[model samples]
Target: MQTIKNLVKDNMRQYGMFIALLLIMLLFQILTSGILLKPLNLTNLILQNSYILVLAIGMIIVIITGHIDLSVGSIAAFVGAVSAIMIVNMHLPPFLAVILSLIIGALIGAWQGFWIAYMRIPAFIVTLAGMLLFRGLTMVVLKGQSIAPFPTSFQKISSGFIPDIFGTESIHLTTIIIGIILSFLLTFLEVRKRNQQTKNGLEVINNGLFFAKLIAMVTVILIFSYVLASYEGIPNILILLLALIIFYTFIMKKTVIGRHIYAVGGNEKAATLSGVKSKRVTFWVFVNMGVLSALSGLIFAARLNAATPKAGNLFELDAIAASFIGGASAYGGIGTVPGAIIGGLVMGVMNNGMSLLGLGIDWQQAIKGLVLLLAVGFDIYNKNKSS
Candidate 1:
C-alpha cells in the first residue's frame, strides 16, 4: 500500500494529465452518446490533429531548452506554399519536393538560430519577426490564392493507409497482428529495463505495480488497435507519428545531446562551465524546430490537398499549448516526448468532443484557452510545492 502511494506521489505530475485525458474521454463518450470512441471518429480525430501533434513534438524540445518559436505556423505556411509551387507549378516530383521543403525548413531554422544563439537575440523577438516575415512570404508565394490538386502520391502521405497482407475482410488482420507484436515488444522492453536497473543496484518499482502497468498498457494497445481495425485500419499518418514519437522519446531519454539540452535548459552558465556548447545546442535545437515546422506544414498541406496562405494560422499556439499541457515546464529543463504527445491528444480529443456536441467554435476557443491556463497553473503549483 505504501509502495503504491509512493509511486503515485512520485509520478503524480507525469500521470496526472494522463488520468485527466481518460476522464475527459469518458465524459465526452457519455455526452456524445458513445460517438466519441467510434472507430471512424477515433480515426478522424487522429487524422485531423496530426499536424498539430507534429508541431507539439518539436515545440516540447524547444521549450525544454528554454526557448519558444512563435514562427512555426508561419514557417509551415511558407513551406507549404513553396512546396506547392515546386510540385504544382514546376512539375517537380512529390518526393523531391518534400526533400527540398525539409531542407528549406532547416535553412530557415538555421537563420533564426543564428540570431538567437550567436547574436544573443531573444527567441521571442526573433521568432516574432520570423512569424511576420514568413506569413508575408507565404502570401507572396501563393499570390493570395490557394494551390490545389496535389499529386496522388503526395496526398497519400496524409490520406493513405497501410495495406493488409493477410487480406481478411470485415477486419484488418494486419493491424491486430501489429498490435500483438507491439504488446509483446513493450513487455520485453519493460522487463529488460527492470533487469538492468536491478543489475545496477537501482531501486525498482514493486513487482505487482510493474506487472499491473504492463497489463494495462498491453490492454490499451490491443483495444486501440481493435478500434482502428474496425474502421479502415491505421492511417499512414499514424505510422509516421508513431515512428516520430518513438524516435524523439529515445533521443530525449538516451542520447548525449539530449542530456546536454536538459543541462543547458536547467542552467546555461552551469552547463557551459561543464563543457556543454550552449550556443551550438541552442542553434541546433532551433534548426530542428524549423525542420519539424516544415514537416508539419507539408503534412497539413498534404492532408488538405492544397496550399493556402492561411494554412497553419495559429498553429504555434496549439503546439505551445500541447507542450505545456504535456508537462513541459515553463522554466525549462523538464518534459518528455510522450508527455507532449499525450498533451496533443488531450487537445485533439477536446476539440473533437466539443464539435460532436455541437459546441460553437467561439466556445471551443475559449474553453481551450481556459484549459491551457489551468494546465500551466498546475505546473507552476507543482513547482512551488516541490521547491
Candidate 2:
C-alpha cells in the first residue's frame, strides 16, 4: 500500500492532467445525459478541434524552448488565403497548392526565426509584429473579402473519413481491426520498454501497477475505436493527428535534436558551452512552428470550405492555453507532446459540452480563462514545491 502511494506521488505531475481529462469527460457525459459521448458528437468534436490540436503540437515545442509565437493565428490566416487563391481562383491542383503553402509556411518560420535567433530580437516583439504584418497581408490578399467553395478534393482534408474496406454497413470492421492491432502493438511496446528498463538497471514500477496501466490504455483505445466505428469510422484528420503525435513524441523522447532542444530551453548558456548550438536549435524550432501553423491554417480552411479574412482569429491563445494546461511549464524545458494533445482535447471537450448545454460563448471564454489560469498556477506551485 505504501509502495502504491509512493508510485502515485512520484507520477502525479505526469498523470495528473490525464486523470483530470477523464474526470471532465465523465462529468460532461453524466451532465449531458450520455449525449457527450455519442458517436456523432464525438466525431464532431475531433473535426471541430483539429486545427487547435495541430497548433498546440507546435506551440508546446515553442514553449519548451522558452519562446512564444503570437503570430501563428495570423500566419495560418495568411497561408489559408494564399492556398485559397491557388486552388479556388487560379484552378491549381489541391495537392500542388498544399505543398506550396507548406513551403511558404516554412519560409515564414525561417524569417521569424532569423530575427529572434540570429538577430537577438525578443520573440514576443518579433511575433507581435508578425501578427499584425501577416494579418494585413491576409486581408490584402483576400481584398478584405472571403473565398468560398473550395474544391471537393481539398475539402476532404478535414471532412473525409477512411473508407471501410470490409464493406460492412452496420459497423466499420476496418476501424475495429486497426484498434485491435494498435492495442497489441501498444502492449508489446510497453512490455518491451519495461524489459529494457530492467535490463539497464533502471527502476521499474511494480508489476501489478504496470499491468494495470497497460489494461487501462488498451481498454481506452478499444472503446474509442468502437465508438468511432459505430459512427463514420476513423476520420482522416484523426489519422493525421495520430501520426503527428507519434512522430513528435518520438522526436522529443529519443532523438539527439530533441535533447538539444531541451538542453537549450533548460539553460541556453550552459548548453552553448557544452557544444549545443543554441541559436540553431531555436531557429529550427521556430521553423518547425511555422510549418505546423501553416498546416493548421490549411486544415482550418479546408474544414470551412472557404478562406475568410477573419479565419484563425484567437488561435494562438487556444494553442497556448492547451500547451500550458497539458503541462508545459512557463519557465521552459518541461513538457510532452502527449500532454499538449490531451490538453487540446480537454478544451475541445469543454467547448463541445458547453455548446450542447446551450451556454453562451461569453461564458465559455470566461471558463476557459479560469482553467488556463489554474493550470499555470498548478505548474508554478509544483515548481516552488520541488525547490
Candidate 3:
C-alpha cells in the first residue's frame, strides 16, 4: 500500500498539469451548470482550440531548443493571406493552394533559420524582426480587406466531420468503437512499457498504481469519445491533432534527432563537441515551427472561412503561454509534448469559461497574464529546488 502511494506521488508530480486541467474543467462544468462539457460545447472547444494546439506543438520544440519564435502568429497570418490569394484570387485548387502555402511556410522558416542558426543572430531579435516583417507583408497581401466564403472543400478542412462507418442516424458508432480501441491500446502500451522497464532492471511503478492509472486513462478516453460521438462525431481537426501528437511524441521519445535536439538545448557547446549538429537541429526546429505555423494558418482560415489581416493576432502569446504552462523550462532542456497540449487546453478552457461567465476581454487577458506568470514562477521554483 505504501509502495502504491509512493508510486502515485511520483507520478503526480509528472502529471500535475493534467490533474489541474481536469479539476478546472470539472469546476467549470459545475459552475456553468454542466454546459462546459456538453457535447456541442465540447466539440466547439476542440475546434476553437485546434489552431492554438498546432502552434503550441511547434512552439514547444522551439522552446525546448532554448529558442523562441515571436513571429509564428505573423507567419500564420502571412500564410493564410497567401492561401487566400491562391485559392480565392488565383482560382487555384484548394489542395494545391494548401501545398503551396506549406511550402511558403517552410521557406519562411528556412530564411529565419539561416539568420539565427547560421549567422548566429539572437533568436529573439531575429524573430522579433520577423514578426514585423510578416505582419506588414500580411497587410500588403490582404490589402486591408478580408477575403471570405472559401471554397467548400477548403472550408471542410476545419469544419468537416469524419464519415460514420456504421452509418448510424443517431450515435456515431465509429467514434465509440475508436474510443474503445484506443483505450485498450493505451492500456496495453503502458503495461508493455512497464514490463520492458522491469526486464531491463529499471524501477517500475507499483502494480496497483499502474492499474489505477490504466483505468483512469481508459475512463477519460471513453468518456471523451462518447461525448464526441453523441454530437456530430469526431472532427477532421481532431484527427489531425491526434496524428501530430502521436508523431511528435514518438519523435521526441524515440528518435536520434530528438535526442540531439535535447542535447543541443541542454548544452550547445557540449552537444557540438559530441557531434550533435547543433546548427542543423536549430535550423530544422525553426523549419518545423514554420510548417506548423502554416498549418495553423490554414486551419484558422478554414474555420473562419476568411483570410483577414487580423487572423492570427496575438497567437504567439497563446502558443508561448501554453508551452511554458505545460512545463517547458524558460531556460530550455525541460518540457514535454503532452505538457504543451495540456497547457494550451488550460488556456483555451480559461478563455471559454470566462467568456461563458460574461467576463470582458480585458479581464480575460489580465487573468491569462497572471496565469502565465504563476506558471513560470512554479517552473522556476521547481528548477531551483532540484538544483
Check candidate 1 and list the clashing pairs: none
TM-score result, candidate 3: 0.98
Clash count, one per candidate: 0, 0, 0
Compared with the true structure, what per-residue lDDT tens digits does model 1 show for residues 144-253? 99999899999989889899899989999999999999999999999999999999998889888899999999999999999999988999999999999999998999
lDDT scores in order: 0.95, 0.96, 0.93
The per-prediction CA RMSD against the true structure, in angstroms, equals 0.8, 0.7, 1.1
- The residue-by-residue lDDT of candidate 3 on 30-65, one tens digit each, is 888889999999999999999999999999999999
Best by lDDT: 2
Candidate 1: minimum summed lDDT over ten consecutive residues — where? 1-10
Model 3 residue pairs with clashes: none
lDDT comparing candidate 2 with the true structure: 0.96
All candidates: TM-score: 0.99, 0.99, 0.98
* Residue range 1-387, candidate 2, lDDT tens digits: 988888888887789989999999999999999999999999999999999999999999999999999999999999999999999999999999999999999999999999999999999999999999999999999999999889999999999999999999999999999999999999999999999999999888898989999999999999999999999999999999999999999999999999999998899999999999999999999999999999999999999999999999999999999999999999999999999999999999999999998999999999999999999999999999989
